[model samples]
Target: CSTFLHKLQRKSNRKRSVVSSGELHRNRRYAINPLGHKWDHHNLTYRIVAFPNTLNRDDTRKALSIAFTKWSDVSPLTFTEVTANATADITIGFYTFNHTDCWWSPLHPCFDGLNGELAHAFLPPRGEIHFDNHEFWILGKSRFSWAQGVWLNDLVQVAAHEIGHALGLWHSRDPQSLMHPNATYTGQRNVGQDDVWGIRRLYAADKKRVCDPWASTSASANDEILHEKNCPLRCDLPLESELPPRHVPRWLKWSLRCGHKNLRTTQNRYKTSPRASRAEGL
Candidate 1:
């Protein structure tokens, strides 16, 4: 079985080529490395520092909270948003100016020197998520909802994907998985089964490795361990609580109730730039 690192090494040695539509096609069909293993439990708690621009702060926090809650449901993992001074394992921030945006790096880098992955996250000891700020950043409750226009990937959706990496999930071949490189808004509340399984596997594999300071194992060993502790041996419980429907803001509900024709005709006066996608090549 080839590990993620093994694949990376092989890719690096190969000639760098333009990521033609052909490359994207190959990537879509690319299988999950038979080598990547489940996560071993480390410290189950993580801290995130979300730096949203003042204009978008409220929406950013709301979206980020929803993203965090998605993972908490799958495992014993808990998350907290902290101030800059707080001791945290993970720090998340957004870019306001497009001058230094790195979001597109996963897709295309400046020079010929390119890394062929979408997002890359460090294991436990290294915790940070840097998103490219080059793209527009939009938030919820608008005309056409998530159904209209150019459908550049959704801000909240991208955050949710990167957050999966922050928690130790590898990219999944399952297009439905949140871990997939490119994703659009699906209006789902949680990670898909494939994403959950991948993260759960990480928890089990990483737990022991993180605790055993004396053990020196490679990615191959971790992969082997995960294959042995596969999904059939696991059990999952549904934890999503039903939220009581409260009267939402009148205008917001009215917008949804408005006929599709009206929605298409009305330009969104509330239209704002969307947040850039998080593209750290896996």
Candidate 2:
């Protein structure tokens, strides 16, 4: 493991780097890291600049390999490891404090020793995934260690989430999606449909669909939505009920919940001048 001084030195060399320091986007569904900072190509390369001391190189690589696979299974993108990070598009590391920074640094001032701010990543074209060395990372079935009184962060799940940011994704509000900002260590690790659309919206070639996010919802579905919820005109639900649907696009649900005015506001934000991606902390 080495200082990310290597990453800082090469700042001038990246194609279209992202800073992740702009205004907040909508708090629901999936977001492209603001300013639409995505990898322009599907085939990308990554490098692991550091690792946890508890694990060996081979095991750590395998964990990260599975994390990248979660994205490749649903998108046209691909990731290859390069021993030389200087040529790699994305770089991974584990750092404790000011030597490295992320979207989360402002709140806790880099890694908050122990359970807070487990990790954060930069958006695409500046793919830097940094993990917290303070937390005990594991590739196990459970997330917390009651015996040890600490959170046992799953390396694979957290890597997948950071990889989402590296591929130009923002934190999603859909609780079931892997991109959700809050559920990273609570065992919601699967890539949901929101996660799939978030990636495809960034890299897909087909541009036929209209930009209206709510246009696809018919009057019938809208009626069903309104009738199903007691709160007419508001899509509010208890946290326990925000499960992602099997075949529905997340926008439809967002539209139904937010109503026309808020939906228009959200659409306007995208239409306005682009800002950098927001810091998505865990």
Q: So what's the TM-score on candidate 1?
A: 0.48
The reply for model 2, stretches above 4 Å from the true place, is 1-28, 84-86, 101-109, 205-282
lDDT of 2 by residue, 8-121 (tens): 323433333232212322333666654778888778888988898656678789989999989886665778899853689999887876645444444224666787677777
Name the lDDT of candidate 1: 0.42
Model 1 poorest 10 in a row by lDDT? 273-282
State every prediction's TM-score relative to the real structure.
Answer: 0.48, 0.60
Q: How high is the lDDT of residue 53 in model 2?
A: 65
Model 2: how far residue 69 lies from native, Å: 0.5
**lDDT of each residue in 40-159, candidate 1, tens digit only:** 444444454544432277676677777777876555466777666778777666443232333453322222111122223443445555544433445642123255342232456666
